[model samples]
Target: MGTFQIEGGHSLQGDIRPQGAKNEALQILCAVLLTPEEVVIENIPDIRDVNKLIGILGNLGVKVKKLAAGKYSFQSDDLDLDYLESELFKQEGSSLRGSIMIVGPLLARFGKGYIPRPGGDKIGRRRLDTHFEGFIKLGADFRYNREERFYGVEAPNGLRGTYMLLDQASVTGTANIVMAAVMAKGTTTIYNAACEPYLQQLCKMLNRMGANISGIGSNLLVIEGVESLGGCNHRVLPDMIEIGSWIGLAAMTRSSITIKDVSWDDLGLIPDTFRKLGIQLERRGDDIFIPSMESYEIQSDMDGSILTISDAPWPGFTPDLLSIVLVVCTQARGSVLIHQKMFESRLFFVDKLIDMGAKIILCDPHRATVIGHDFHSQLKATTMVSPDIRAGISLLIAALSAKGTSAIHNIEQIDRGYERIDERLRAIGAKIERID
Candidate 1:
């Protein structure tokens, strides 16, 4: 495990660019398995999860060529199907949540897919039922081995597209099903699909690759089966979760920072959510300028109720940003309720914040009421273990804004999502050092 030694109380200033979308890269990397042609992807974030997926792809015999920094071309023409059943695959696939996405494209192209129970941050119960159910709806045979903890999807006669109404707006599940349905025999209509920018990017990229897909930014998607897909160049949008984190960091540390090339139009409700907490930010062209804040207060509702910040499906406040918001609220002028709806265990990390002298009431596993410290009482730095990716970044932001130097252990959790976070933060005048 790695640790981050962060010295707090210093303001950060500079232009920082958000990395390519992590969620989008997970889906897009898996989509490369759909076609045998060269799919050139730009702005691929070199994070642990993404790198793990790319390594898995290379191990499965996909020709992965590095075009440049943040750019790569993948060709699946020489895929090794037998590799999927190997012990190496079983072990490696179990370590990555994105491994489940490979099942859909593999079942679509190779008529079979096998995956060990996928693993990611232990935020909550991440069910794969949606992915399996979608495959079954598309005429794929689904089987799970309880003892081995492995899932297999196979369609010997090839997949046939059909209507699917998802149980929930699951991002990965939607991406997997969409990838499978694209090459199926007929038209597939997916209702209640996740319409996040990640999915929209996937749809656009597939369209560019000759897959017929409509409904770019809505909950309903229509995909017409295509005979084959060709190569296409795709550039991922900026990471909105990271953008939200940066916004929170600036507010907490009273920094003046500009997030450049943020793909502002695709950010959805992210900026407004931070603004709800009275964050001062401006959109200059595609960049977000977060001015150094002296003191900002959380806005109460129009009816004079305590402000409540909650997560919802896309076009609503993203669940991922709720952690950043929760951390930022600890430094705001007023109190706010943070409700994390999607994950049961995400808010458990608030205990660490409470330990740091922030006034927080853990109402439940999903809700917390935070009374802002407002710099009148800054958090005292302490040691902490990173629980998950989002929570880790949240804690890091908190640490940077605290009064003393704090050490965060298990920083691998943070690295899984954010690419070289310490280096990037250091470049922007953050006093952070990575300790091995």
Candidate 2:
């Protein structure tokens, strides 16, 4: 496992740019398999999970080329279908949760898609029922091998579009079904679909590739099936979760930081959500400017109730950044309740913050109450193990704002999301070094 050694209690300066949306890149990469022509994608994040999916694509005989940094072209004119059933594919597909997305496009075009159970963060029980259910609704035969944890979808007669009301507004699930529906024989309508900016970007990209999709920014998507799709150039939006993390980092470390080209309109409720915690963030054009804050207070709810911050679907606060917000609140001037309704085990990392002298009550697996120290009592740095991608970044933020130097082990989790985060932090005058 790799480690990060960080010296805390030092403020940062200079500007940073958020990487391309990781979530968007995952969906977009999978979308490339839908067409035979060249599809160019820009602003792809250089993170582990994204790269893993790209590697899987390459292994499947897709012509992959790197035009430049954060730019690539993929042409899936010919694919090695046998690789899908090979042991190598089983291992590779099982290693990445994002790999599940490839199934939809493959099933749409190739009439069959098979994959082993995908692996990801151990935050909670994330089931694949939604994806399979959507496929079944589209007239695909779904089969599972429980002992091997393998899933397969096949439609030898070709997929026929149909209406599907998803059980949940799952981002990946929505992307998968949309990809499958595009090449189906008829119209497909999806309700309760996830309408996050990333999903919207995917929809727009598919449209550019010749799929007729409506309701770009809403939960109800109407897709008219087309026989085939051509390739088009697509650029991913800036990652909103990373932007939120940086905003929280600036507030906690009392740093003056500028995040450039953030695509503010696509960020939904992220900026305003931070403002509820009394963090002063301003929009200078497309960039976000967070000034050095000695102390920021949590805003109470109207009618004099305690403030509550929770995650919801698009236009709602994102669950991915809740970990960052939770860490930031440890140093704010007031109290807030963090209700992580999406995942049961996400808030468990608060125990490490409690170890660092932050006042937090782990109300349950789903909720926590935090009383900010308001910088009066800075955290005492200590050794910590990164639990997952979001939690690791949250812990890193807490470590950077603490009193002494701290060591974080298993930093591979952080790398799974952030792109060369140590180098980026060093550029912003942060005292961070990576150790293998």
Q: Give me the candidate number with maximum lDDT.
A: 2
Q: Please give the CA lDDT of all the candidate structures.
A: 0.94, 0.94
lDDT of 1 by residue, 1-436 (tens): 8999999999999999999999999999999999989999999999999999999999999999999999999999989999999999999999999889999899989899999999999989999999999999999998899999999999999988898899999999999999999999999999999999899999999999999999878999999999999999999888999999999999999999999999989988888888989998898999999999899999999999999988999888999988899889888999999989999999999889998999999999999999998889999999999999999999999999999999999999999999989999999999999999
Provide the lDDT at 151 for model 2: 93
Model 2 alpha-carbon miss at residue 189, Å: 0.7
lDDT of 2 by residue, 1-436 (tens): 9999999999999999999999999999999999999999999999999999999999998999999999999999999989998999999999899999999999999999999999999899998899999999999999998998889999999988788899999999999999999999988999999999999999999999999999989999999999899999999999998999899999999999999999988988988889999999889999999999889999999988999999999889899999999999999988999999999989889989999999999999999999999998999999999999999999999999999999999999999999999999999999999999
Q: List clash counts for every candidate, in order.
A: 0, 0
Output the worst ten-in-a-row residue range by lDDT, candidate 2: 157-166
lDDT of 2 at 419: 99
- lDDT of residue 152 for candidate 2: 95
